[model samples]
Target chain A: MKNVRLNALLAMGLIIVMILSLAAGKVWVSPAAWLGDDLSALIIMELRLPRTVLGAAIGAALGMAGATMQGYLRNPLADPGVFGVSASAALGAVTSLYFGYAVTAWLLPAFALAGAGIGMGLLALLAGRSGSLILFTLAGVILSSLAGSLTSLMISLAPTPFATTEIVTWLMGALTDRSWDDVQLAVPIIAAGMVFLFATGRSLDALTLGEDAARSMGVNISRLQWFAVLGVGLTVGASVAAAGIIGFVGLIVPHLVRPFAGHQPSAVLLPSALAGALLVVGADSIVRILPSVSELRLGIAMSLLGAPFFMALLFKMHRELS
Target chain B: MLLSFENLSLTLRGRKILDTISGQFQPGRVTVILGANGAGKSSLLSCLSGLREPKSGSVTLDDRALLSLNGKKRGRMIGLLPQRPDIHWNVDVRTIVGLGRLPHSGRWGMSAADHDAVARAMEATDCADLAERKAMRLSGGEQGRVLLARVLAGEPQWLLADEPLASLDPAHQFDVLERLKNYAAAGKGVIVVLHDLTQAARFADDIMVMKEGAILAAGPRNEVMTADIMAQAYGVEVQIGTSDTGEPLVVPVRRL
Candidate 1:
């Protein structure tokens, strides 16, 4: 019932903020002018609409992947980030940027998605023979940390002011000057992620008890694990590559929603997806409103709010663990 | 006969776990395997449930070889409760149990029929009340009952439980055992690996005693519980007695 109420409020709020975000830019256009044959219509349709849609879509994908990973791994502490997929994806996007391809509107999200897929695939392969979740987590730590430092080093070595700015923007995350191309690139990948994860709902639910129980219940454990790996890769990879690191959407949204979804991992998927969409779009809308720094990134804004939020979450987790 | 293990031999890490063991489990009878630790009791159950492959022999369902079957086919015939279950999600009690319906349901979701079966299983195990509670938060005994409900809901013709009563406190232990006996009496075959000889003798229609991966004795409780054989398998002198109602009981004493 709380999920229902929250869903209704967030949904209405999302629609309202989305419209305002489309119109309430640096030079505010009348709603009439945007609907007419002015530059405002072009800005709304070709610029803001795609950016918002991509943000919402990627947010849903990341959120769904987080919930799925949490469910499939059966650990609340686990998320797409735990598997190192996010870091690997970031490396992929940065690599694309380092090569100057990140400037090409078409090449950016594509390279990012590939990097995510490869990172996740490698991580899963490393953890494949491990019979324990701890081993998988260990592998994730190794892969992501190694990848993360390497990405940082590349940024440190970047040749010019342009390279530094590009790296920083990618890392901090922003939706400014986002064209329709990014939305196009992210939607397909996110859709594919949703399909893969949603298809494994039953098996993931069975996995809650344990692999032994899931196997006894006729769930193919190895196959289901692959599905989870792929889902996380596709979703988190695309989001990170497209938007850099948007912190807390995966961790916070799913934790908040799963109990209301009856604690079933499968049931939490789309709800997390919707909640993800709302969070990113809503946050992006707020980023638009700050009059002082018009170009202030959505990612930086979120981290400013979420870093403390994350610290609180860590504290809560510690207390619960004790 | 619903299930049979035919000349089964399994080796793990160069040690024989089940050694050419042959057994027939019939419907309406609770067949209990009684043994000391390292007696290959859990391994034997694992082989029967298709968790592990026997090195040389086959477990069958109604003369059909279970070894040749896929997981789905075996799942319909045998429901398993392993010792020390490993959880990967924090699902509710009912949802955990509802997983037992996997074999009978479709890929997308559970059908109404599956839900009904799950409900019935949860009801039988007295866990219906805890349906929405997170399984990990439950006590060890409650968790055991929930897992049992899961296996039961799968509607398997045979049940395999490994030390199913070990984690439970005394009261709930008897309650779970009674449910097992009832399942058997309702024409389902049950093979339980038991550490408690008293409970074994109390509820089992036939007791198979094992030591070091081989059967020490196999017969009705009265014949299997003789002082000499019990001492040989257990490495301790023990007294066997019957209640006023004529049920077998074991009382352990020190080695002579």
Candidate 2:
């Protein structure tokens, strides 16, 4: 019953933020204007609609993906962005650009998806072999560094300066000026990933106990791991391909909503997804209203907001350990 | 129907854990497994619970290979509690116990029968009062009982617990053993891994002794708890006596 209440509140929050997103920009379009055929309606329909929709979609995907990955691996630090899955995906999309495949719409997202799959597969292999959190984090750091360097190398080797600028801007991550075409490209794939991730909720709940007891309880741990990887790869890859690299939303949303969800992985999923949508949509609105010469990238804003929270969590953990 | 192992052997990495062990466990009896450290007693329990596969031979239940059944199907019949119990989240005790019903839960969630089972198990284990409490805040003995309640909530036909008495107080241990014995008397199988031979002798209907990854002896309590077998299994000198209740009592005198 509490979960239902929380879900209802989060849904309300998402709707309110989306409305604020539609009205916050330089063109102040009211909800009344959106109901009629006018300039305000056209701007809302063409511009803010896709941006708000993608923000919620991407946020929900990342949030669900984060909860799934953390629960499946039994590691709190296993978000797609933190574990280099996003960086690897960026590398893949940039590689497509380097090869002049930007003209084709599907190839970049496909390559990004493939890159995420490979990265996650390798992480699963490593994590399965060892239960050491340090080792797992080190492996992610190495993978992220390698992918980041490769992406920089591609930018340096691009044929033209304008191409370099475009790659650089895309790498920074934003949802500005996106149209229905971008939304159409990402929504279905993200939705599918969300389905896959949410389906593993029960298995994750069983995993709250160690592997041995979970196995005794009839959870197929190996299959659950594979499903988590496949789901995270698809969702995070598509989101990155569409809006570059939106970091911290995945990392922060689960932490914020875990308490209200009763800390059960199965219960944590839906609330985290809703909270994620709310966070992104709210952040996008804040960026629009701020007095700035240029639009603030959504990904950068999240990191700026989340890094301090991450630091506080680390310190709290340290104090608990000591 | 019987739970029996046939020449079961298991090797971990390189070293052998359980070496060609064979045994039969019947319902309506509490079977206690006793062994010194590293005697593969836990490994045998793992095999019986279907968590670990034997490199050779088979474990069968009702003439069907236990491992051949899907995890949920097998879990509906057998529940195993490991030596260490851990709850990763700060969930409520009721929610933790509710996890035991996962194998039986349908798509929508737990049924009325499942909820009744959970409540009954918690009541049986004296954990119903702690239902709303955060599971992680429980003490060691409280945690053990909660975990036992979780396993009991499954209502499996066979209950296998490893070192369940380790962190529990003496009263809780006896209470738990009495519950297991009563469950067995009501026509279920209860297999427990115990280090206390005296308690095993007092509570178990049957006893299985292991040493060096093999069973030294296994039979009815009277037949298996002889001085010679105890000495051989533990490399110790023991004095045996009869309690006022007519149960056997074993005391370790010295290391051999």
Candidate 3:
């Protein structure tokens, strides 16, 4: 019942934020004018709607990815950002651009997906299955640096100055100018990733007792690990391909929702995904309404919001431990 | 049903943890495995519980290969309570205990049977009152009992526990041992890895002593609890006496 209520509340909040995302942009797309054949309606249909939908999908993906990683790794600090999964995806996306293959459509995200998959595979090889927390963290840091440098190398070697600017802006993360094509590209992959993540709910709960205990409870740890890592790779890769590196949505959403949703990883997943969608759409809306001459970057806005929350969480954990 | 291992051996980090060993455990008997430190007690438990695979041997449950069974089916048949029962989160005690029913619970979560099992296990382990408390806040002994309760909730046919009484107080220790003995009495196999020989002598129907990754001696408690076997396994001279309750008592006099 509480789970249902929490899901409902998050769903409601997401709906509200999504609607506000459509209406809060530079254009005054009122509810009455939303479906008419007027230019305002066309703007809503062609522009804001796709952007809002993408925002929600990306947010949900990040949130679910974060929750799944944290639950599977049994560490609250685990996230796609920390694990270099997103960095590798960004590197892959940048490589696609550097090779001018992104103009072909579909290739960009495919490459990004491949990069993310390799990243997770390498992490598994380096860290081993059920790696200790320190070893996993160390492996993640190493991978992140490697991917970051690769991305930088690609950016530096780009033939055209236009490519550099485009890459930089994309890396800043944005929801602007996203069409139905972008939405169509990212949603199916993100949805598939979400399915894998959602399926892990009960297994993650069983895993809270540590791996051996969880295995005794019939959780196939290897399968669970593969599903979770694959799910995060797909979602984070697709999100990065579509919107660049949107930092901290995955990290923030689970932490934000965990208190109300309870600590059960399965119980916390949906609420975290919903809250993530709400957060991304809301943040996207907030940035559009800001007075800056240029719209604030979605990734930057999330960091601005998420870093403080992360600090507060750290302090809370520290106090509790002490 | 018979739980048997044949020529089981395991190596970890290039160090032999369990040498070629053969053993059989029967239901309706409390089998206590006694060993000194680094005696591969935990390794033996892990292999029995299907948490580890032997290098070149077979573990069979009632004539079927143990490793061939699916994890859930295997889980429903055999349960293991690990040492140092670590709970990653501050989950409520009921939820922690409910986790044991994962093998039984369906996609929709706990059923009536699961709930009853959880409740019954908690009551038997004397952890019913701690159901609402956060699992991480409990003392070592309380955590041990809660973990045992979690394992009991699974209603497994075979129970393997590793160092369950190391941190527990004497009262809780006896309470836990009595419960385990009762579980065996109810026709389930109970295999416990213990350091304290007196407790093993008191409660174990069968005792197997291990040293340096090999079984030194194994038999009925009376047959295996002699002073010579105890001294050889533990490397100490020990006094063997009868307790007030007519149980065997092992008191370490000095190192050999």
**Top-scoring candidate (lDDT):** 3
iRMS of candidate 1, one decimal? 2.9
Off by over 4 Å in 1: A1-13, A100-111, A122-137, A159-161, B7-16, B85-92, B132-137
Q: Which stretches of candidate 2 lie over 4 Å from their true place?
A: A35-37, A128-132, B242-247
Residue pairs clashing in model 2 are none
Give the runs in model 3 whose Cα sits over 4 Å from its true position.
none
Model 2 chain A worst lDDT window (10 residues): A126-135
DockQ of each: 0.57, 0.67, 0.78
Which digits, one per residue and each the tens of the lDDT, describe model 3 over residues A1-322? 3489889878998898888788887766778889899899889999999999999999999999999888877888878877898899999988988888889999999989988878876776676366468888999999999999988998899899989988888888898999999999999999999998998888888878888888877899888878887888899889998899898888888888887887878888899899889989999999999989999998899888878888898898899879
Model 1 error, position A193 (Å): 1.3
Tens-place lDDT digits, model 1, residues A1-322:
1256656765776677667777776767667777666777888778878888888887788788878777776666566655677778888888888888876875766776777778777766776434466777887789889888989887998887799788977788777776777777778888888888887787777776667767776777778777877777788877886788786677777877765665777777778888888888888877777777557788787667756766787798789779
Worst 10 residues of 1 chain A by lDDT: A1-10
Please rank every candidate by lDDT, starting with the best.
3, 2, 1
lDDT of 2 at B148: 88
Candidate 1 docking classification:
medium
Q: What is the number of backbone collisions in each predicted candidate, taken in the order shown?
A: 1, 0, 0
> What is candidate 3's CAPRI-style docking category based on DockQ?
medium
- lDDT by residue (B75-138, candidate 1, tens digit) is 8888888887655557778778878888787766678899899999999999989998888798
In candidate 2, what are the lDDT values of residues B1-256, reduced to their tens digit? 6999999999998999899989999899999999899999999999999999899989999799999999998888999888888787778999899989877887678889999999999998899999999988899878988898889999889999999899778998898898888778889899999999889999988999999899999999999998899999999988899889887789999999
